[model samples]
Target: MQTEKVVNYIVHWLKDYATQARVNGFVIGISGGIDSAVTSTLCAKTGLDVLCIEMPIHQAESHVTRAQEHIKQLKEKFDTVSDTRSDLTPVFEAFKNEVFFDGDQATVDMALANTRARLRMTTLYYYAGLYKLLVAGTGNKVEDFGVGFYTKYGDGGVDLSPIADLVKSEVYELGDFLKVPESIMNAAPSDGLFGDARSDEDQIGASYPELEWAMKMDEAGKRAEDFTGREQIAFNIYKRFNTANKHKMIPIPICEIPSNLL
Candidate 1:
């Protein structure tokens, strides 16, 4: 995709949405990942008030540092850009100790990670409400739609999704065009939820390039058998994630009564 065209589209989309909603600006959680960096930059380009919040829950120091750097760069370019950091380690620890202390280790680990995401979501909304700003989402197409690799009512909850249509590769392309800091652009994509800082590919069992290809093939009605060995394995993994997380990608199902029963 043409970087300039995509940037222009997102900037105009944000401006138009804010005008329609009569909101003052946007509030986005900066995760130091390419997705957030790109989204924050697009929001800042609108010249409206944009708050880049760093909500870290026992996050890696490197992640925090990169986020700060990105925010600093944003401030240099857009006077409307502002930033604040919220450490959520205490709250997360409390939840784990009070709620999931006796749970299975695997289950507890997953719960704790999800809690971190939800906490960040809460923090973003808190600032959004206080400043009359919309919560801008940073999820991309492959993660948000193809695999549903996001927390429901957590990272998935947002007032606006500026880059939801772009794939992971497309996001990196935009990041390069926007001149995002090399530290952030080059870093492995992680949710920053786990303590060990496992990359998204590590957690998901497939690289983004593989997943993106699988998604495109699936969209074109291709089956796993079309490929052999490793490629098939990747496609199967993609299908499994998509199936398991379908609920996160769609609206809640509702029961309907027959028309004659009205």
Candidate 2:
């Protein structure tokens, strides 16, 4: 896909959505990642007011620095781009101290990480409400649909998802065309949720390229048994992730009654 065309399409889509919804602009959580960087740049390109919030809670210093740099570049390019830095560490610590309970360390850790995402979501909505802006999401196709990698009701909660159809590699392509900072473009992709700074690959057990390939193969009705070595491993990982996170990707299930009864 041509980056320029994709950029133009998303910008126009955002404009149309906001205008029809009677919203002033977009509010996005700038996570210092390529997805957020690309999404924010696209939002700014719409020439509408954009509030890029950097809500850091025990975030990696490198992530924070990259986020600041990206926002600075955005402000320089677009007058409509404005930003706010929110320190959410105290908020997270208070929640942990007051709400967390003893359990499996891994489970507790995952919950805390999710809490961080939810906090960021809340902060975005708070600004959205105050400014009458829609909360723009930054998730891409691979993470959002291929593996359902986002936190449910956390990062997954948003008024709109602009790049949910593009794959991870395609996001990088868009980022390059948008002239996102090289520092962010070259950095490893991390959710910045675990506090230990683990890359998404470290948690997902497969790189974006591998995952993308796996998704393609699966969609084409290829079986893991037909592949060997790393291909097989990638297929297996993809299947496991997609199955485990299907609940997150699919809509809520509801019971239906027979119309005759009514």
Candidate 3:
């Protein structure tokens, strides 16, 4: 399908969700990343009230600057929240200072990353409640649902995700079609929570082209649930979601029946 048609479809679908939910606007975080930039642009074009929150906690100056540039170019209304790292540092420190090593540096980093996500989510939700707006998620198919790159109930939480079905490459293609600024499309995709320590590709270990192929293959039809191939590297991310099964499903409590029931 043409990118314009798809983009229009997504925007209208999101508007329906907002109307059905009785929301006045949408809030999205712009991390100088393509996914968020594309999402913001779509929301702006769709006539939805979009608030682009640039929360640069531990992020580098360049990332924040590029994020602002993208917001400006998109002609979207936005606000900056600085020193956010100070607000979230205590949460990360507490997790690290815990008695057990259940959370190591890597784990701590993940938690810290999630803390940022949750903080942003919380802020969005707060504004959503205040203005009766919905929180529009910027996650693409590869990151949001495929590899489960987002934290449960943190960045993963959203009232509506317009691009959730579009893979990363497709999202970029759509962005190009929409005339999203080159800086946004050219910027390296990152969460900006790790402060240059990691990138989307670095964390996922496969380019979006490869990831989209795997996803399309998985969706089309597969001989086995485990399909190994050149895409194995990308598929490993699927393994992470599988191994962490609890994260995949809600925690269910076992029922204890009394002897009388027998």
Candidate 4:
């Protein structure tokens, strides 16, 4: 697929979303990864005020540097930049003391990562309110609506997602066409939860290509076919769709009669 076509599609999609939401601008938390870079720039192409927040915790020094490069690129192309960060040490420690008494560092890291994502979402909303913009989600098709690699009530929360239909590899393709800095594009995508934690690939045990293949299978209505050796990858994608159930439907009501539904 041509990258320019993808960019045009995203720009048009964002325009439609903006008109529907009655908002003139968009905000994204740029983690210096290919996905966010692509999303932020595509929104900019629509002439929307795209604001990027660099919400890196302690382990994300490299991403912080990358965020600066992303900011420079955004300034050249977009309307504004909101370089923001919140250290999660205090909040992490407090939660650790209260509930994670004997938990390992990995557990602490997971909790902190989710917390960091939630904080960034809150910050995005704060700016959105001030600027009359919507909090744009940077999640890709493989990450957000597909496999659900985001935290609920955190990165998963958003007013709109410009790149939710593109897979991870497609995101990189678009980023390259947009001339997003090569460093951010080349860096292995990470959530910056732990200082040197395993990334999506390591955590999932399947590369992006493999995951994308499974996603295609599911998309083509082939989910029930037996694929025994690939159970892990299937399980990961399955969990993603399962947990993102909230995004797929309305909140659970106390009682819903069939008559009421009709």
lDDT winner among the candidates?
2
lDDT, candidate 1, 149-207, per-residue tens: 99998999999899999999999999999999999988999999886568999999999
> Each candidate: what lDDT?
0.92, 0.94, 0.71, 0.74
Clash count for candidate 3 is: 0
lDDT of 3 by residue, 215-250 (tens): 666667643345666566566655555356445344
Q: Is candidate 1 or candidate 2 better by lDDT?
A: 2
Question: TM-score of the candidate numbered 1?
Answer: 0.96
Off by over 4 Å in 3: 76-103, 220-230, 240-246, 249-262
How many clashes show up in model 1? Answer: 0
Q: How many residue pairs clash per model?
A: 0, 0, 0, 0
Models 1 onward score TM values of 0.96, 0.97, 0.80, 0.82
TM-score between model 2 and native: 0.97
Native-vs-model 3 lDDT? Answer: 0.71
Candidate 4 on 1-262: residue-level lDDT in tens?
Answer: 7888878987998988898888867888887778888888887788867777766556557777887898887787655544555555566567557664358977766777787778778878988898888888888877765566788778888988888878888888888888999898889888766656457777656667777877777667665445656765564556565465546433546765688678
| Model 2 per-residue lDDT tens digits across residues 89-162 | 99999888788478899888888899999999999999999999999999999999999999999999999999
Question: Best to worst by TM-score, what's the order?
Answer: 2, 1, 4, 3
Model 3 weakest lDDT span, ten residues long: 77-86
Clashing pairs in 2: none
